[model samples]
Target: MDYIAENTNFKLKNSAVTLGKFDGLHLGHQLLLEQVISLKKQGYTAVMFSFSYHPGNLFSKKEFELIYTEEEKLAKLRNTKMDVLVSYPFTKETSNMEPEDFIKDVLIGKLDAKIIVVGQDFRFGHKRRGDVKLLQSLAETYGYRVIACEKRKYKDSIISSSEIRKELKEGNMETVNEMLGQPYSILGEVRHGRKLGRTLGLPTTNIIPVSGKLLPPCGVYASKTIVDGISYPGVTNIGFKPTVGAEKVKGVETYIFDFNQDLYGKFIEVELYTYERPELKFNSIEELKQKMQEDIAFTRNYFLKLNEGNNSSYSN
Candidate 1:
């Protein structure tokens, strides 16, 4: 993927582009991306216009949990096979530009967009004055095609980045995974922990995810961990160990069953598949160990049954 940083010596001539924040690259964003990809095949170079920061983050005091980091977003866009990725810095000066100026100066003048694709609810420019209709009018004047992608709905709900974040925050992994086209994953490096699990005969690999990430609710989850391109089924916990009288800060720790490998200081991706149960305090260390054993057993059975069901459906 070609990365074009803001204010850099980079320019594209006559490109087909999609404009959006594209936080999670959820189904709705994917629809617009698909349109852009289709345009690329028709002899148009595809470009994506996105801001470095979410617009709301600039004005609002409350921090929003992002589904992916900037690197992750670029990776996702690369999968769409876009020819160029244009990242516009979100500054007060850029934000103050009028909607018309943004289209004429940035989109048309800088990128030279021959075709533009966006979602139905897409908006841009100062105070978000540019709507789909405004974009269409501008495209007509500039001799470019304007495509508005319809909203995507799944399970009677709009598949939006905000909705996906809400689902993840609520521990609704199943729905979030469906909307994301894969399991929601956290990419991080394995870090050293207190090794309490090791004392219990269940050594774990602890991970400290990047800041501002949307973590799943504190609990045990059936997950798949990938390290150096190899995947392993595992049980992960995202919480403070209340039973062992640990601190209140959040953490993600995973125990991969039937696998032993030294992974300290290595980057890995942990994909949450399903929510098992919430974190709880146990009366005794023996009780906690016993419950962990049960959790592992349940996870194994659950995956086996799930695979069997998939095989049966395929046979049918």
Candidate 2:
């Protein structure tokens, strides 16, 4: 797989290119990617053209908390048949380019796009001046095919990254996970903490967050902790501890319910299955421990029911 920055030195001929931030690789993005990948059977290169940073974040006051960072995005796409991954630098020059020039230069001239796949709502080039109509009109001149994938829906609701983010922010983990086509997860290295969970008698492995990553919510969750390819049931807390003195940083602390082993400095992944409760400020350490005990009870029952349901469904 080729990783090109700015523009490729060599023209990528007969490429099937799709453009977007592809933040979460949600169902909508996956639908478009399927179209891109399908073109590979006809000998076209599968190329994903996305900017290094989301364009919205550059102009808007709110920074985009990405579901998948650059590394995570690339890692997620690794198993797919994508041929080239280009992170075009989003700058004033690129943003100001006219729609025609973007098609003529970046898409046709620079990337050598043979087939372009995008959503009907696709916009590009200078204040979102380009749309599907413009690309369709120029397809004859550019000598390429245009595939416009319609909006995808799940359970009669339109699926989008923003919608998923909304669900995540509200701590609707089940719905968010369903939209993502898999478990919504964070990948990071285990880091040292204050060993406070140890004091509570539930020693935990602390996980550092990926820079600018979108966390599900600041709370406890029923989760799975994956370390070295082995998964363990876990109860995770994500937030700055208000009870144990204020800390500026937010972190993930997971107590593995299945196994115990030294995991400091190990790169691990945690998948939040369900939101349990919000972070609370307790008056005393004992009070905090009491709530944590209830949280564990809820966490254990959640997984047990999940397991029983799966077994029942399988037996049926």
Candidate 3:
């Protein structure tokens, strides 16, 4: 797949494009992506057009944190059938573009869009005036087809990135994963730590999450660490090590089961499955060790049950 970002000289032709922030790329966003990808059979290039910055950040003092960073988003979409991914640079001037100009200059002019896909409530352009209706209205003039998808819901509530982030902040991994259509994962390069886990004979791989990346409540979680594409069950802690000595930046430290090969400087994805407990400051190192052991056991049981369920379903 091709990635276009920070540069505007590249061009795509005969593209089926889906436009959105695509922050979490949840089920609702996936529907729009599916629509664009489906047009590939007709020989149109599947393109995902998103902005470099979250639109909310431009208007609000409370900066919007992303469920997936640009790199992480690329990693997630890299495995998909997408032909092109464009991260349009967002600026005041870009935001001020008139709705029709956006349609003309970006869509029809630059992308050569043959088909456009978006959600029913999708909006864009200055003062957020554009909508699916506007796109459909210009379809005839632009010579492109407009396809709007209905919102996806879970238990009658709309599935969205904001909702997923809310659940994540509350450490509701199960609900977040369900809404995401996959595990909520942190992808980063292994960083050097104080080796506190090593001192306890329970070594772990540590990673510092990128700035503006949303993380769950500082706590221990049942997780899976993907090393070289193979997933290993793990007990992960997402926080500063308060018991040993609190760090300035947050980190993701995971103890992968049955594996201890050197992983320093290697990039890995740690997927959270279930929340276990909050980060605590133990009175002594022994107390911390005991709690960590318990967390590891819980993780083992969690994956064991998951495997059993998968096996049962396969048999059925």
Give me the candidate number with maximum lDDT: 3
Q: Name the regions of candidate 2 deviating beyond 4 angstroms.
A: 6-10, 311-316
lDDT of 1 by residue, 162-196 (tens): 88988899999888888887678887889988888
lDDT of 2 by residue, 197-280 (tens): 887788888877877798877999998877777778878989988998866888888888857688887888888889988988
Candidate 3 has its poorest 10 consecutive residues by lDDT at: 307-316
The Cα local distance difference test for each model comes to 0.83, 0.85, 0.90
Q: Rank by TM-score, descending?
A: 3, 1, 2
- Model 1: how far residue 283 lies from native, Å: 3.4
- Residue 235 in candidate 1, Cα distance off native in Å: 0.6
TM-score of 2: 0.90
Least lDDT summed over 10 consecutive residues: which range in candidate 1? 307-316
Span of ten consecutive residues with least summed lDDT in model 2 = 307-316
Best by TM-score: 3
lDDT tens readout by residue for model 3, 1-316: 9999976677789999999999998889888888888889999999999998888887788878999999999998998999999999888889999999999999988899989998889999999999999999989999999988899998899998889989999999888888888888999999889888898899999999998899999999999888898888889999989888799999999998889889999999999989999999999999999999999889888888878787322111
Q: List the candidates' TM-scores in order.
A: 0.91, 0.90, 0.96
Candidate 3 versus truth, CA RMSD in Å, comes to: 2.1
Instruction: Give me the overall lDDT of model 2.
Output: 0.85
Ranked by TM-score, the better of candidates 1 and 3 is: 3
